[model samples]
Target chain A: MKQIEIGHGSGGRLTRDLIKNIFLKYINSEELDPLEDAAILNLRHQRTAFTTDSYVIRPLFFPGGDIGKLSVCGTVNDLVVSGAVPRYVSLGFIIEEGFSLESLEQIAKSIGEAAKDAGIRIVTGDTKVVEKNKCDGMYINTSGIGEVMRAMPLSNISDGDAIIITGTVGDHGTSIALAREEFSIEAGVQSDCAALHDLLTPLFETDGIKWMRDPTRGGLATVLVELSESLGYGVHLYEDRVPVREDVRFISDMLGYDPLYLANEGKAIVITSGESANKVLEILKRHPLGNNAALIGKVSSKCKGVRLKTRIGGERLLDMLEEDMLPRIC
Target chain B: MIKTQDIINHIRSLVPGDRKVRIMNVCGSHEHTIAFSGMRSLMPEHIELIPGPGCPVCVCPESDIIHAITLSRRADVILVTYGDMLRVPSKDGSIRAQGRNYKMITSPSEAIRIATANPEKKIVFFSIGFETTTAPTAAILETGVPDNLYILSSHRLTPTIMEVLVKDAEIGIDGFIAPGHVSAIVGSNAWNVFSEIYGIPTVVAGFAADNLMLGIAEILGQLKNGKIRTGNVYAGVVRPEGNIQAQNIMAKFFEVADVNWRGIGYIPESGLELRDEYSARDARKVFGLKEIKEEKIPGCICGKVILGKAYPTDCKLFKRACTPKSPAGPCMVSMEGSCNIWYKTN
Candidate 1:
């Protein structure tokens, strides 16, 4: 096959050949064939959930992990938190010309490793390259598919589901900020980039999980707002219970940023029945990734929006994050 | 290992009387910790905690940012700073909102790296912060072979502000919660002048809930004993003499000067200016911005908030008109601002 170039995305035989020869060869599963504008998959019995996300993090490599690992972990965490068992992921890559082959290989390997860790498969993918400067090294887009098992009963999510955040927020964003060539600090912060499905398996085995979500682009604030709008319920988070790393806290303080609004690559926020909350926390605490996990708040019937129960027993509204603080830092 | 409850009990014991007292914490990190950890909840009803102007970002005037932005417009100068200052807006525009004329940096050492990498372009780091950040800036100066780089130092000293606050402020504060990190550099003795002259007690407290309450306890203890003194609850990181090495470095490259704070107005000798020996790296020397005037957002109450003359909520723009997403004032824009803290955690 002819070596593909940026021209392939311009609509020609190069695009067809690249898709058929590369994408199909690797993701030759029956369900992922791109017959139309989209891949149509049949769902026989289980409830289905779908999500799409794009990763445009810079530097791409840091103390603990890289963007490839982040792309997969982020999307999988999303599916798992939404009360679904992640089954498959479709990957897309936009590469800059002159990018190193070795780096590409490493990234692909990390993606594979992350998929295995999450117990999901990369069933389909596409790749295209643009001239140097046309792309900032690389960008990845992922769409996830998950199955809501028939045997598992999903909570309709009533007024009193407890809100639990697995691990600290803002670690990944802070690590990325520290790794930036421009910024430097004494604190050693690493990206909290990992798969949370292993931690979620036990919780999924429980009977009270109502709604769950991984706080990604906008962190926990966005997640709470979504739940509040959807369930028509209120959330009261205790500022004290939220787990924030000292390094993360310091950097945010120094930069005038809030950890609550920062992004997290390897974390999940689960909302379950208040009665099952303790049991779910017990399951999570036994897992390494969730040792610092906290039951930061609970769903309330009165407030009707996201509110913070101050350490002083006062109330404050948690607003949507405004203009991105430290954009592209994640 | 110090639990928040332990601190609460200590505070309760210290404030056993029926009289009301107020304490102000000056560090931005302290503000962040107090808000995030919910430390204010543990306080007795009579003891009210107040925020200070010590947040380095909150205190930096908008004119300085305008000056830095103007210098950054120079094709040869690469503007550097910690990420927090990147988005801060000036009268003309924010360095970020204006575009890529400036670079957001993490540390002073990275500015050195950028200078090293470019070799040709002049790099000017817009150094802003208090004692915690001043040390790194001092480190860059000590390295000494300065040829292609400069620092526009807006670094302020905490003690100077404290002196101004204790003498003139009508805040009725019974004591002071001196900045813990700053105390580690300038030493506990630095605040002795304020304590001796004003007869108001001071305590250097750590950021943790227990540490803060302990500092408050010690200050109250001093009040009960009728002895005004400087106490250190953060002795682990702070000391009576402070970090001598950092002090020496700061004294070498910069000299104390009068500078205008964004909200608090001008306090004599409160800010650090680049000494003549390092004048070549100074942006004011590179670009004549000496004529620039201090301008503030009209009707903004950041000044009153910083001076403890008014609470953040007392400002007309405070949640109703100004917010973190759309800040109408400098204090509302910064994480250390009392308004920001109030908004983040009530």
Candidate 2:
């Protein structure tokens, strides 16, 4: 008998193998097969995107947001980035038998409020309780549906395109990490969790927008690596120009983490044409969610891996994550 | 303000284009800076930064790993070590890939907690690293340990191995960007002999991009004047006299012994073994696992790679037979190992 390892849940190479061998073979449709974070389906002369995400973050709550807010934003963002206007989301919960009723009510209240904040409805949901030994304290899953408003494609993404992010990176990761108290250091950090439908909607209507992705697991470097390999073009990031929270930077140095590899919930990594990058940045800066947006780097015709020009004066490749730097970061 | 561009300009003004300088840095973070900062883009085309065996996991011999893996398989033993050593490849398989009940720790002091939590099991703390890391482990040992705890000492001395590098002229080391952390513990004045005896200029610098370039600039200045001297440009943290208390603690608990480096083979008096008073807590002696043998991967040149004599890509197994996920050697395992750093960055 073989036991499962933590690597199986990393959402990197090991996770890829697990999904490809076990799940995709049986349940994957053409739209669902590629695993592009969400599936876009055409029905009755209407285009819509459907996505589902599970939130099982340990401690159930952290500095900024809890599992409730994460559940809504995580699913809604999946549909929002997939070229859709988020319409409705359904929630499901699995609780241990001994879980507190007060915690459950608080989670439910937060989820309801989050749905209102996103301007979406929690149209449906289900709940279940399992034995204490068989489960964590709480786990929430959300499935979302969004009506397609405009077409956003990645086929136009090529060399010379610029890569940009919404705000300071690694806040979500650093927040959860500090909450773990693994390093015995104190930092007043919080997760950047939010619904992006308002901020990203205007950008959805803009030109030069080739691709969009929320760097959830594996962080920005992994996203760049995936894009580079899939498109066969190199992704070069200006290391100094990459944004990170000052506190997160200090904590990362103390904890030996490369913030580039930390998770981000409220930020989006976007690719746009070089011709319209500045115009796009201006628009992104105007939005509240993207006030700190900056053009980090551009696509290149160099090595087929993610490259970083350091703040000091060295250049190197950024490899696809081989192992989980922070497990269950999302 | 120590501007990197001004330092680069100074370096450029000093070195003739015809004289290709092969500078070796014996620290992982330095290699990281060279790659992460694209610092090479600033250097003249003639200057090349070669990575040395400063990374402890890169030079950890395979025999110790085999022993650790064996212990990991035992029902009564819990092998505790740093995260970097988890995936290191041995003849059979890596500790992460094959072993069971292996726990990862960030520092030597954390072993006490793990040992306390697992009171019934034998907690074998796999203490493997250089002097800077060893000093902390030694200090903790002096504080005392749990009765069920043992230590597998695989510590190596940095200066002794740097001496080994100088003796091997084929390494093409023009001068050294000395490891600052180790120097901070071993003292900056300790590296003078490389300049005094081998005529190779050495500069101790911190692990910052500006610090590295400035150190290289100073070395270039020395080369231009044909001056053989050991210099310190990272005086902010590193002093002529290092942390003497740390040095004394390290010396108190460990004795110098001839030991084998993974790829570079045996180097005399370059290893640190637990002293006789601490033999009761020594895992190697207690387990009677005295005759561990080194096994080589057929075509892997991690040996040459560790010595700064060859690049990782120069090896046949770099991306094909070996990778970060499926590593075939120690160099590909550690986050700071030259192979791992080069693969991820370059």
In TM-score terms, which candidate is top? 2
TM-score of chain B of each: 0.94, 0.97
DockQ leader: 2
Model 2, span A59-78: residue lDDT tens: 68888888988999999898
Error of 2 at A146 (Å): 1.7
Per-residue alpha-carbon lDDT of candidate 1 for residues B111-225, written as tens digits (9 for 90 to 100): 8888888888888888998887888899888986348887888998888887777776587777888888788888988988757888889988888656777788888889888
TM-scores of all candidate predictions against the true structure: 0.79, 0.88
Q: Relative to the unseen true structure, what is the C-alpha lDDT of residue B301 in candidate 2, on a scale of 0 to 100?
A: 88
